[model samples]
Target: MWASILIASFGTYVEKLVGYLLPHHMLERESIRRMTGLLPVSMLAALVAVQTFAVDQTLAIDARLFGLGVAVVALLLRAPFLVVIIVAATSTAFVRWLGWLP
Candidate 1:
């Protein structure tokens, strides 16, 4: 077991070292940077979509959608980050408390 852990840790360390040593020119390409910049946002959006719109093995839209919309509106209005999170969470909790979802 210790051997396995040592091997795994060594492999991970090597991979990170290679990434850290890679030539900057490779990452400096305009298209690469642009796409990389969007990757995080796209991934988070996908995660949120799955959680908000899926139920068990199927798809469903419910009160979570309302909370998400409200949160988005608050973000677009440049509300403080904490305010957006709190409003979204509170709205979701209130909806659940009211038994808006079955």
Candidate 2:
């Protein structure tokens, strides 16, 4: 376990070092700029999908989906970030409390 941790740490350091060593021109390219800008959004979407739909090793259809739907609607309506989060959490808790989903 220690060996694995050391290896991963060293690999991460090298990866970051290589990123720093990369030419500025490469980072400035239009395609690279676009990808970097969109990467976080895509990653967050993937994370949400996984978290909302997956339970343990299986797929789940439950209150989480309703919560996500509420979040999407809130986002479309231009709700503030904190409001969106609170609304989603409240909706999820309400659903769960109704004993409609486990």
Give me the runs in candidate 2 sitting further than 4 Å from their true place.
1-23
Q: Which candidate's lDDT is highest?
A: 2
| lDDT by residue (tens digit), candidate 1, 18-99 | 6689987877799988997899899999989998899988998888887898899999999999999899988988898999
lDDT (C-alpha, whole model) for all candidates: 0.88, 0.92
Alpha-carbon TM-score of each model against the true structure: 0.67, 0.70
| Model 2 TM-score, 2 decimals | 0.70
Worst 10 residues of 2 by lDDT: 18-27
Clashes in model 2: which pairs? none
- In model 1, the clashing pairs are none
Worst 10-residue stretch by lDDT in candidate 1? 15-24
lDDT score of residue 97 within candidate 2: 100
